[model samples]
Target: MSLFARLAFLMLCTVIPAFALASVAVAGSECPAVDANDTQARNSLMYYVCYHQSSPGEPAHTALNPAELPEHIKWTPSQGHELVFSQTRSVYWIRLNIRNNGSERRLWYLNLHYPLLDEVTFWRGDQPEDVLVTGDQHRFGSRLVDYRYFLLPITLNSGETRSITIRIHSSGALNIPLKLETPEEVIAESNHLAVTHGLFYGAILVLAIFNLLLFFSSGTTYYFYNALYMVAMGLFLFAMGGFANQYFWPENPKFANTSIPLTLALCALAMTFFGRSFLEVAAHTRADKTLKAILWICAGFTGLTLAIPYSQAILINTALGLVIIFILSIIAISRWQQGYQPAKWYVLAWAIMAVGALVYAAAAFGYLADFLARESLMQVAIGGQVILLNYAMVQRWRLLNDKLLEVEQKARNDLEYKVHERTAQLRSTMRELENANRKLATLSLNDSLTGLYNRRHMDNILPDLCAEARRTGRPLTIALLDADHFKAVNDTWGHGFGDTWLQLIADILTRHATRPRDTAVRFGGEEFALLLPSTDLEGAQKVCEAVLEEIRTTSVEAPGGAKARLTMSAGIATLLPNENQQEFFERADSALYEAKAQGRNQTVIADT
Candidate 1:
């Protein structure tokens, strides 16, 4: 052979084994070999079969496929003797063809996870068992096993096909058959995922319920918005195959496709409304209005997607809308940092919700892939959003309470200031009135000559005194006294001497009064009057006689150094009950006239 031909043969020898190994790895060993004549049978098979040997190091059995498994097919870790694969799909009839190429007899039993959905039974040669072999060894005695068999049952010889017929019901878990090999480790891992999913969904539900309660209790727009937002977040988590379906309603798959877009739209609406209220954005600037308009447009598009029945369109729009929301959240945060105190909480809450929404949107749009056994990231994000929003709401409530208290305190302070001002004004007015009273008392009722009660005081108090005398049946009397020949004295000693004489007489009358209730007034000119409450006619006459004698004998020094004699006449009268001041004064005057007519130095009393 030539050198080129030998090199080609060596290359072929090396490449052929590699190709064979690659093919075996891609397609499992249990996969049926394709034949040119069996095109129809090849086209009908939905899944390729692969197998691994059972050994001490390896698990009992394993299958490998290049195509990725669905999210629901992921395994969880749990301890159980039996394993079942359960799934729900719109497509009908799943075909399972197992090729047992092992030499040893294998004893296996099959039990449906949801047994009420269907009955499955295996055919053995020409005879089929009425009851299927179910592994219930714990309930049945070991010696009385119902359908015990090795890998090769006596009823099935080598190279014979044994088929099991599964009849599916149309609703709930009954809608699909559970297919799995016994004692598989994948079932345990899947159960753990299912449990975690349930817990996550429960947490979302609790947050939603709590927010709803707060909304009703407070009636604040923030609480209302948060409630709606939390509810949407919870539904989104459920739709994403989180705790909701795993624990609460695992059998139903209808909500899986519908809740994602619906929740996204609702959350967007809630956040927009919340921003408007919490930040008081409408009051601050016009940017809030633009955001609101955009949110509404997004909502309209989401509704249109729902109505159109196109899943891909809905998913795409949902992703875009969520991105817009995240941008809005960043803008809101920037505004808050710029000194809007209320905006701080709003931005923080929205930021958390944005992260949750993005995670869910990524999962929905196939932007991120997740394993089955992992807890749903969307559900965790919803929980985070709920916590953040609740915190924001609490801060908002505290801020509002503080504002209300400040307003009330301000109002109270204002009212107190007004009251203080008014009280000060009233006190000033009262002081002015008291000063006027003092001045009036000095001018109208005080005697200029002797600082004693004047005739004006008599006029002010005499009527009340007479009325009191009548009521109490007490004696009331008056004495009218006049300085004698006051004109002659004024001519001889000048007016100053005459004034001195009059002042002396007023002082004498005031000082000589018998009781505290007695009042002496400078009547006018050289005249003076004395009022005695509780004094009768006899008592007044005696007091007047004493006053007359004292005035007659008293000597007054003139201003020019000459001595002068001063004398006075007195007229005494007792008050009559129920009489007018005029009548009382007339009686006193008549007595004074009689005294002057009889003599200038004597005292006289009027007849009753």
Candidate 2:
């Protein structure tokens, strides 16, 4: 075509390629370079991450290839060790453009500290053979290293730069902490964790066994619950610490993955029952019902963790755990406020444990960064709780023993004094017996709810009143009152409100029956009887109308902020000479029916 045209085309191509390479080099400068002689591990290396929306059935490797990954995603760089994605289904691709600054070949371990990830694929450069796939979702044997953490061994040549990419996906919290460590560092870290975890789980086991024995010997339910709590907490921490999959069920990936939430749920359930019993929650009526409800919810949640997805289950379990902690704290504080001495220790112990648990949960959900011994903080808190609870148990036993001794001493003193004061003691006993008989008689003669004369009182008093009216030749009348729409009130406003309505009616009857010879009686449900002595039917009717008028004007509280008025139907009957008490009651009841049939809220006198 032409010499100048060809030359310009070649120059343009060369300049454009160089400019692109320079841009990449500037971006790569942000990444950290590893030196073989470095003594410390590198956790805060600059890395670029991108997320891929993958379908459910897609394989992790095929979801996004490293070569074709950046078509739609822009690589975002994150500084420090804040690699937290809370419980996601999307695949994350993390790229580290690292250079080996040393002059000699060096081998390093890329450790992913979180082992609960479902799938993790790490590779150096673009080669498929360099990829190593391992996570808790796979068999433990598939991991390159035999450690609890996912450790991949990588070799770097002297003065070489390579791009390391990691693909991670999980059905749990994706709070991955990645580190580049030398073999010595890995060994040291592993040894430190082993010693700490050994002590942690070992303490839990010992406490469980000791409390179990105590439960068998003493038959105390709190001890049994505490033992179960210890066992469940130990298993849960074991699973969460990645030891369960490594040592217990290496080949059973599903069980290993499920164990974390399952054991945690069981731990929560056990703690709920233990708190209820240890705190003596049943002593408080509302708190007792609340804890009972929590027990049922915890049990159902524990079973639900088995069937639901791990992400959702773990979230719900954390929330349930927090709720239990709050409820127990409230009960413990309430007991302490009421001067229950042992509740002080429970409050202190649970406070420490709750703080630790909240911090641990925050760290796990990526709210807090890892600090010194942060992972083991919960274990320490639980250990403190166990010791404090055991101390409380001992103190309670001593208190009980002291009370028993006091009771024995009092009994001996009473025996010694019995002979010296026999006459006075007998007189006091007689007085006490009389007082108890009076109280029992009052209770039998009165309605428990309304505190008015009951049907039994009516049966005893009506015959005497009729006989007296006949002897004295005084006009005696009885009024039977029934509440209008009483059943409808009960059905609409609940039985408790209906009870209140009955009490209100009883009060009106009481106000009208103020005379010495007048009596107010709760005959049955929603029906009241009033006996007026030395009064004619006219006087009884006037009293009844006044009572109905007061009831109609009195405001009864209804639902929805509206006020309601009450009404009643009353029938009056006057005793006749030679009429029996049964005949008098029947006539009064018939008159009441007549009043109700003639529309309620009015009084009708019986025909003599």
Poorest lDDT segment (10 consecutive residues) of candidate 2: 15-24
Give model 1's TM-score versus the native structure: 0.40
Model 1 segments more than 4 A misplaced: 1-195, 242-256, 341-360, 371-375, 414-608
- Per-prediction tally of clashes: 11, 0
lDDT of each: 0.53, 0.75
Please provide, for model 1 over 1-608, each residue's C-alpha lDDT reduced to its tens digit, 9 standing for 90 to 100.
Answer: 22332233233222221111112222221334222123343233223222221222322212111122232232221111111111222212222343333344332232233212222223222343432332111111121222211111222223333433222222211112122333332346347655875677677677767867776755555667766766675665454443333344434434433445566667667666666666656553567667777678767866865664324434444555555566567667766777766566666666665565554443232233231211255556556656666676677667766765553332232244543555444322433544554576578778776777777778877887788899899998988988778899988888887877877777677667858678888878888899998998888888788787777888977676767898888888888867887788788888887988997788878888
Q: Highest TM-score: give the candidate number.
A: 2
* TM-score of candidate 2 to 2 decimals: 0.60
Q: How many backbone clashes can be found in candidate 2? A: 0
Which segments of model 2 are wrong by more than 4 Å?
1-32, 40-62, 71-73, 125-129, 371-373, 408-608
**Which lDDT tens digits does candidate 2 get at residues 381-452?**
888988888887777667656754553332332233543544344322543544544476476878988999
